[model samples]
Target: MTPVLSRRALNRATLARQMLLERKDISVLDAVSHLVGMQAQTPHTWYLGLASRLSGFEPSQASTLLENGDLVRVVLMRGTIHLVSPSDAAGLRPLVQPILDRDLQNNTMHSKPLKGVDLARLADMGRRLLAEKALTAKQLGAELETHFPDSSPASLAYGVRNLLPLMQVPPRGLWGRSGPIAHSVLSASGSLSLDEMVLRYLAAFGPASVMDAQKWCGLTRLGEVFSRLRPDLVVFQDESGRELFDLPEAPRPSEEVPAPPRFLYDFDNVALSHADRSRVLTKEFYEQVRPRKNFAPQVVLVDGFSAAEWDVEDEVLSVRAYGKLSRADRAAVKSEAEVVLGVYGVRKVVFV
Candidate 1:
């Protein structure tokens, strides 16, 4: 009989893998790599994601790496920006290029203007321009317009971005700093194969199904890869009887394990990576805090599931629960909020 993982059991596994069950004493780079990379579309808020999973994490640890070129924010999974190591930036960009290509072809706004444009030539131009020096999209678009006069500059720049492996250089992603969104060519490369990438994904976010991996990376047709690796991988079924794949040695703790409250940044992969988010986000809570106008709220996790939405403004961290919490859960949420506020240098928290 195939072992069945209940929702709570799956939640515990996800929390354990994400380091949310307990803060680990790992280096920031190691944490980033272990989790396969964080969804870091937002700039400084991503530091909070690290703070939640790492013990004694300091913003400078990652900031220095970004400045020195050890870490990069690039378009990879889902065609959104992610904070990743140089090697991952090189490897994943090419692997997920199809996502960008499909987006370019189907884009409601940019596709029409980009039609009939020589994308290969545009990519060449973008590479040459970025090689000389990093250029903002606006600047790169202006330069490309001189050559491709028929295409809209904005559309041309959008097309180039999809067609090339451009990374956003600092101080754009550095903590406590700000800069224009500038692009530069990524010169790093990695030989990580699709098989290896899938294995790594399972190591980080698994006991997940094939759909979950596809949701994380925005790539389709990975069911075949999972099928190819099935003999080497352990398999289980969720309560719904959906088959879940995992590394043989990956930790899947007891369902009754106590889960500490965790604060997540708006774009944290933990909430967004899975096809069925019931492991971390209950449908009722999701309906209560569903994104407004595509804006996902930062979340507070209680008992390993999203229970509230949080925001900080004017030195006040405000938490709004999706439903009534037990007295103990309320205290736990408050305590975790304080720790989160300390990371932001805020001194106050309020529940509403």
Candidate 2:
């Protein structure tokens, strides 16, 4: 018989799998790879997100990982920047190259300057310059114009970034440090191949549909491998009867799984994992909590749903309730908030 999972059950299972139910005992790099990649549009906050999920979660330790070759910051899935481990980025980048290419062509912001020029050649030149030394986009941009004469500064930066498999080079992802935009090409990282990273995604987040995998990695060219692996996968259906995919060995816990108060970053994958996205935060909750359409570190959950949103500003933590939060649920939220506040050495939390 097919197993049924309640909303909270799924929430707890997801939390456990995501390492949010309890902090994990693993390296930052391992954590990043397991979760696919943390939502890292604004890079520094991404670093913080990873820290929050790991045991001890030392921000400095994660920074050091970024400083060394252990971690990297680059755009992967959906064509957005993410703080990924070196091994993960190397493999994930090539897999997502098509997405990178499409974004380049569709870029209303940059297409004019790169009209007729070859993308491969631009990547070649960028790969060369970034081989020995990392350079800021400012430095890269100046040289790009001199080389690609037809391209404007903005267009040149955008074109080169898309063409070359570049990483936001280190000191860039340090704990409290947000460096000016700088990068090194993919070749310098010397990490795993794209094939391996795609395999890793399937292993960690499988039993997931092609669209689910595509959403996770920001790529969709896995037909051959997925076809080969289909027999090994365990399939299920959402309430709407849409087929859902997953690995047989992966966590499919009972619906009564316990999900504690989780403080998630704005770009967290849990909120974005499924196509429907009803598993985590609802559309109404999103509209209510998020003042702007897109924002991060949405730190509140209760009864398997996003109850409210929280933020750290001027060293103060502020929370806004989206809907009704029961008394017991409010206590749980306060407890988790206090722990997070302790990280920042805040006096207390204020719910507004």
User: How does each model score on lDDT?
Assistant: 0.90, 0.70
Misplaced by over 4 Å in model 2 are 1-6, 188-199, 221-225, 289-291
Off by over 4 Å in 1: 289-291
Q: Record all residue pairs in model 2 with backbone atoms less than 3 Å apart, i.e. clashing.
A: 9-255, 206-246, 207-245, 207-246, 207-247, 208-245, 208-246, 265-297, 266-296, 266-297
Collision count for each candidate, in order: 0, 10
Steric clash pairs (candidate 1): none
Candidate 2 is scored at a TM of 0.90
Find the number of clashing residue pairs for candidate 1: 0
Per-residue lDDT tens digits for candidate 1, residues 71-140, read 9998999999999999988878888999999999999999999889888899998898889999999999
